[model samples]
Target: MVVKRLSALKRFLIGRPLKSNELGEQKLNKTKALAILSSDALSSVAYGPEQILIVLVTLSAAAFWYSIPIAVGVLVLLSALILSYRQIIFAYPHGGGAYVVSKENLGMNYGLVAGGSLLVDYILTVAVSVSAGTDAITSAFPSLHPYTVVIAIVFVLLITTLNLRGVTESASILAYPVYLFVLALFILIGVGIYNILTGHVSPELHTPVGTPVAGISLFLLLKAFASGSSALTGVEAISNAIPNFKDPAPNNASKTLMAMGTLLALLFTGIVFMAYYYGVAPQAKVTVVSQIAEQTFGRNFMYYFIQGTTALILILAANTGYSAFPLLAVNLAKDKFIPRMFTVRGDRLGYSNGIIILGVCSILLILVFKGQTEHLIPLYAVGVFIPFTLSQTGMIFKWVREKPSGWMPKLIINSIGALISLIVTIMFFLTKFAQVWPVLIFLPIIIYIFYRIKKHYLAVGDQLRLTTCEPAMPIEGNVIIVPVAGITHVVENSLNYAKSLNPHQVIAVYVPFERQEENDFEAKWMKWQPDVRLVTLYSPYRSIIQPLLKFVDTVQRKASESNYQVTVVIPQFIPKKGWHNILHNQSGLVIRTKLLYRRKVIVTTVPYHLTK
Candidate 1:
């Protein structure tokens, strides 16, 4: 009854389970796919521009203008990544992304490294995105500042629940918020640009004057570039999740990738350009986008609307991680790098285990970092860029080895991407070494765990393989032992079942805590004359299961020496009420657990239902 209620509650939460045939229907079209897959990249515009100014602002107020060129640099890298991933989509449509590309071309260790990095990045994506979303909210309403961690965790759980409901369902629900954010940003950028071009708003009005604290150097520019490169964090997600697209999956996924890249470039460029024109600096609580909106629209409905949509899209950005993490985990699980449970689809045909795991990890990160985006930002880009480099390099290897038609141009694009990504990775390590070192430490540990999991699965495969094994043979003899607490209907039922086994001998064993009870039990057994041999082993310390286990071990050893199998039958009474279970001891459960690994010993249970 409790199981039924719990199952009903699950159905209510995630909706009815879809049949296997409905899986194709769950494949997403380009629009919904854009919402589900591209949201992380799209929503990065909310904070990506600000991350640049955060670094540049440290130099001087004049350093703010440098954001324009840095944004341009990031856009150039974005183009290369888009082109390279488009080729990746066509080349490897089955969609393990870097892990598949690297494994097939570069080897298993490289593949594990790429897979582990992406998994870490996906987790950080959830943490950073949700935390950033909460920041937007706290910016809008200072009253919620104290609950940032709670709010971030709530958003993580919300996205996780949406994903668990199934891909198509989540896509449908999240599609509007993403489009709303895009629309809001387009309006903000257009109005802000128009106001600037006309004499309505002066850029000089908002510009600040201050002495330079540090001179602008190549290293500083690279640091700013590395920070802003987080905008490209979700670019590879489309390639990772090509299988989630509708039929002609590769074509659809590629189209989505182009659409995402185009929108991201436009939004990122507009925001950064306006942020420069407006002379907005990163505030302790307010976001750069929020500042731009307020400067342009003066805290009107449009201002709140932009903030609301930004928060929504930022929260929804976690959908990309939700979409890609599970699919990537499924691929890893199929290859035996992770647990096989991640490969199993839930009732809604989603990788529920992977989604839940990602949610838990993200929540822990939010808690540990107190939902601060700045703290998480350093860990984010390095994880993503490592995979970006590995994936692009893997593509280079693919083209050189496969040398398919037009492989030269493809190789060139991926080469540029690989080189740029490698440089950015090195820059992240050098610039953010203090904050990003933990990622370096974590990557090796995760890769080691992957190899360990692979080894275990391989060992299990070897043990369970049937091709080289001999056929089974019938048992020469059987000895059955029944353990009883006292003579009752439960014990009688077990003895009846034991007699039905047609064993060579049936012996009933009992452990008595006191001599009086042993004498009374033996007298009762003799009076009943049940025809089955009865034995009682006295316990000195009032132990029950210990003596019974010792005797069973002895019986099994003798049976094994005689080429006979031993089966131990245990009698248990099932109480009518669920809470009634606590009224009885779990000796049967304990014995079963303890003897589970003993070879040639079979344990069976005879259950008698209780009326009262």
Candidate 2:
């Protein structure tokens, strides 16, 4: 009844279990897909402009002048990426994303590099998005600043729990917030543009941020471009998730991808334009978006509403990672690069284990970084460009190798994408080495780990491979031996089962500790025995498994010499309550461990259920 109630509660919370056939029924339409997968791209407008300003402001207050130009570069880079991925959607509709493209075209090792890069980027997405979302909230309620880390962790847990219910469910739950955020931002951009044209913008904060960097170098602008590239974090999510869409999956997904890119391009352009128009810079107490929001909406209810939606969209943007990471993990596992457990779907037709892992990892990152969004952005920004370059280059190789109709145009676009992405990755790394060191160090370790996992799985497959031949006929002499501790109901039950095997011989072996214990046990066994042979072995070391193992080996060797079979029956007591297990020693477990690798011996366990 208790188990049933818990099941009921879980089903009520996460919904009833869906059959394997229902997986397709749970797919998203373009609208919800846009909402779920595109939130990161859209919500990025909230922070991308600010990251650029944060970098440029270090040189001089006049550095804000370069914000639009930096944003234009990022958008152009964004367009190249979108074009490259659009080709990927049609060619690899099954949805392995960069991992598939790289593995298939660049070779297994290179593919693993892409997989590792995406894995790191996905994890950092959750951490950075949750922290940024929490920052948005705390910006509105300054008193909540002290608990930002805790708040960020809670938000991660919430997102994980929601995603566990399945992708369509999470998309539905997240769609309204994404739409609200986009709507609010579009309105803000429209009003801010009018205000900018009319020269009615709000003045800068009375107490401005300190300008740290003295002069602007080529390196400085390049670093700012890399920083602003945070906007590109989730551009590949839809491409990675083509399988999650309804029928005509790839087409719907591609259309959705284009829609997302257009919206992101527009919203991002508008936000950066408005930021520069209002002369807003990153301040100590407030965010650039908030400053723009206050100026456009004038601290009215709409302003707070904008903040609310920004917080929601940021938290849900982590959904972009939650959606793609599991699918990529499953693909890697399918290729034998990772464990096969990730390939299994859960009760809700979701990759529940992957979702749980992503959540826990992000929470740890939040704790380690103390939920500081600015500190995490640099780490995540570098990870995005790795997969970006890999996927684009892989696609270029694809078009060149295939030479399908009109492939030349795609070839040119993707080549440009690959070069731009490579430059961005190298520039980002040089610009933020101190901040990106941990992720850089982590990447090689991840690649090594992937290789190790693949090696282990291959070895395991070799060991488990089956030979094709006729089965060995049953041996004339079949022997059954039960390891007896003493005469008890448990031993009697196991002995009876052994006898039921109808073996040519049934023998019970007892390992004696003390003389008196052995004598009493033997006498009791003789008196109570229905009909079974008894044997005894003396142990000087007081090791039960060692002597029993030797006795079983001897019987097996004797039987094999005469072409006979032997089975070792072990009696185990499974206590009803978990704590009750500690009351008894686990001798059966010890014996099984000793004989685990002994192919000559066969061990059978007879579990005696303990009700009390």
Candidate 3:
């Protein structure tokens, strides 16, 4: 009944099992795909620019002046990645994520590097996005700050469950919030721009750019670019999920990628410019974006509206990782690089195992870091850049080799992208190595784990190989021995079934603790005078399994000489109510488990299901 109730809850939450024919119906069109797949990139703007100021504000007041340059660099790189991935969408056209691209062009080792990085990134994406979204909530209601970790974990759980309902359904559920967020942010930017032109500002608008700061250096500006790279983290999700798009999947995916890149660049640049103009700094608790909204829109409905939508979109951004991670896991599993269970489609046709794993990992990260977005950001940036570098470098090689129409220009563009990304990756780690060291330590370990999984898969496949279809020799005789505790209706039912097997003999074996009880059982057996023979044994040590093993070995030794096979049949009584099982000791389970490993002995169970 408990299992049935859980199953019903699952069906109610995720809908009914999707038939194979219904898979086509689950594909996303452009609008839904953009909302579902682009959430990560689109939502990153909420914190991406703030991350840059976080690094620069430590330098000096003048260091804030470099944010525009960093934003420009990010936008340029975003453009390159968009074009490079558009080529990838058409070139491979089956959702050519970095892992697939690197595996195909660079080799398996490089592919594993890309795959591992992405795995870490997607997990961190959920962690960081959830934490950041929760931060937005705390920004509005400061009293809720203590529950940040709890709220982030609950948000992850919700997104994980929603994704398990299948792709299209999740997209449809999330589209409205994403659209509302877009509308609210643009309105803030518009009204903020108007206020700036009119020379009117709120009292919250005045704040220092920096204090007690170090001088800005060339290295500091580069570090700022690395910090702002959070904006680019989710851009690869579209390439990973091309197959989820509607008819002409590649074209639709490429368009979605283009749309996402453009929006991300615009929002990231706008937020940074407005923060600078308004002198919004990194607060101890609230975000700079919140400060800007309050300064421009005041503490009115629009102010709360933007904060609410920001929180919604940031949580929805986690949906981007939710969509990509399972698909990447499935691709890796299909290639035998990961556990095959990752490839199993749930009742709703989603990669349910992968989704649940992603959720659990994100929850752990949230709890470990106490849902601090700043701490989570460095971890996200490091993982994201490695895959970004590999994917672009692979694309350059792909274009160079293929030399399709206009391949030279595409090659040149991806080459520039590869170089910039490689620089950012090196600089990102060098600047943020302290926070990223844990990930670096785990990457190779994860790679080795996947290798071990593949090895285990191959070893099992080898053992399961069949050399011949039928048995080499046939059994001359068969004996059925039923394991009995005492004479009961369950045991009697088992004995009758053993007799029906038409074996050479049917015997009931019992191991008793005391001679008095053995005698009493013997007397009862004699009085019953059933057709089966009763064999009794004594165990002074009170060990049932040891005595049973000895009896079985003796029977097998005698039977083997006559070319006979042995069968041990145990009767099991199953209670109707689940709690009733707790009322009874499971000796039947113990006997079956112990005798299963013996050679030349087959164990069969007869279940006597109780009506009451």
Candidate 4:
């Protein structure tokens, strides 16, 4: 009854189970695919420019003007990544992204490095995006600032539930908010631009001036560039999930990738340019986008609308992680680098285990970092850029090896992408090493674990292989043993089942706490004795399973001398109510658990149902 109620609740939450035939229906069209796959990259504009200004402002207020050049730098990186991943989409349409590209072209070790990095990146994407979304909420309602961690976790759970409803369903639900956010940002940018051109707003009046902490240096500019490059974090997601698209999956996925890249470039560039023109700087309480919205529209409906949609899109950006992580895990699982459970689809035809695990891990990051976006940001891009480097490098190898038409162009594109990605990865590591050291430590450990899991699976396969084994032959005889607590209906049921086995011998064994009880039990057993022999053992330590195990071993040794197999049958009573289970001793359960690993011993349970 309890199981039935729980199953009903699951159906209500996740919708009805999807059949295998319905799986194709779950594939997304390009529009919904864009929303699900690109939300992370699109929404990063909300914070990416601000992250640049954050580093620049540390030098002096005047450094805010440097944001345009840094934004251009990030844009260049974004373009290279887009082109490189498009190549990946066409080459490996079944998807696995960097893991597949690296493993096939480079080697297994490099592939594990890429896989581990992307897995870590996806986890951080959920953590950072949701936390940033929560920041948007608190920016609109300062009163909610104190509950940041709670709000972030709530958004994580909400996105997790939506994704668990199946990919197509979640894409439909999440698509509109993404479009709304794009409209909001475009409006803000257009209005801000009109105001600037018409002399309604001036940079001199609104720009902030800060105390100069240090003079601008090459290191400072590279740090700012690295921070802003986070805008490129989600570009690989489309390539990672080509199979999630509808028919002509690879072509559809490539179109979505192009659309996402164009929108991301426009949005990211517009936001950064607006921030510069409006003289906006990062604030402790409000976001740069929120600040720009307020300045462009005042504290009006438009300002609130921008904040609302920004929060929504940022939260949904985690859908990218939700969409990609499970697919990547499935790839790793198939290769025996992770648990095979991740390969199983759930009731809704989604990778439920991976989704839930991602959600839980994201929630832990939120709690650890107290849902602070800035705190989590330092650890964010390192994981992503490492894979970007490996992927482009792998592509370089592929183009050189395959040398298809236009291979030189492909090789050059990936070469440039690889060099830039390698540089950005180093910059992130050097600049944010204090905060991101944990990720650096974690990557090697995870790669090692992947190797260990592969080794274990290989060992298990070797042991289970049938080719080296001899053919089976029937046993000469069977010896059955039944353990009884008392002369009850449950015992009778078990004894009957043992006799039905037609064994060469059947023995009923009982352990008693006291010697007197043992003698009494033996006398009673002799009188009530069916056709089976009765054995009574006094347990001086008052342990039931241990004494029974000793007697079973003794019987097995004697039976083996005659080429007989041993079987133990125990009786268990089924309680009428779930709570009634607490009233019973559960010795049968304990015996079954203890005997599970006993070599060549067969154990079976005979259950007697209790009505009351």
lDDT of 1 by residue, 458-485 (tens): 9888877897555554678889999888
Question: lDDT values of the candidates?
Answer: 0.90, 0.86, 0.87, 0.91
* Candidate 1 vs 3: which has more TM-score: 1
The candidates, ranked best first by TM-score, are 4, 1, 3, 2
Show model 4 residue runs off by greater than 4 Å.
Answer: 205-214, 470-474
- lDDT by residue for model 3 (251-292), tens: 899888898887887788789988877877888788888999
In the predicted model 2, the residue pairs found to clash are: 58-213
lDDT of 4 by residue, 1-612 (tens): 888998898888899998998999999999999999999999999999999999988976777878888888998899899999999999999999999999999999999999998998899999999999999999999999999998899999889998899999999899999999999999999998899899988758534444244587899989999999988889999999988989899999999999999999999999998888788878999999999999899999999999999999999999999999999999999999999999999999999999999999999988988998898887888889888999999999998888899899889889989999999989988899998899868888998899899999998897777975455546898988899999999999988889889733888889999999988888888888756888888888999988899888888888778878889998998998788899889889999998888887899999999998
Q: Model 2: residues >4 Å from true position, as ranges?
A: 202-214, 463-477, 535-542, 582-584
- Ten-residue segment with the worst summed lDDT in candidate 1? 205-214
* C-alpha root-mean-square deviation, candidate 1: 2.2
Candidate 2 lowest-lDDT run of ten = 205-214
For all predicted structures, in order, the TM-scores are 0.96, 0.92, 0.93, 0.96
Q: Write the per-residue lDDT of candidate 2 for residues 1-612, one digit (tens) a residue.
A: 455778898887788889999988889999999999998888888899998988888876667778777888998999999988998999999998988999898888778888888887888889999988988998888999898988998899889989999998888889999999999998889988788667686545221233333576888888889889988889999989998999899999999999999999999999888887678879866888898898788888989999999999998899999999999998988888778888889999999888888898898888889988888888788788888899999988888898999989999999999998998889877988888888768878988888898889888777666764345666786799898887788987898798888644889999888888788878888788847888888777798887887888888888898888888889987887766767889878888887877887788899998787
The whole-model C-alpha lDDT of candidate 4 against the native structure comes to 0.91
Q: Tell me how candidate 2 scores on lDDT.
A: 0.86
Greater lDDT among 1 and 2 belongs to 1
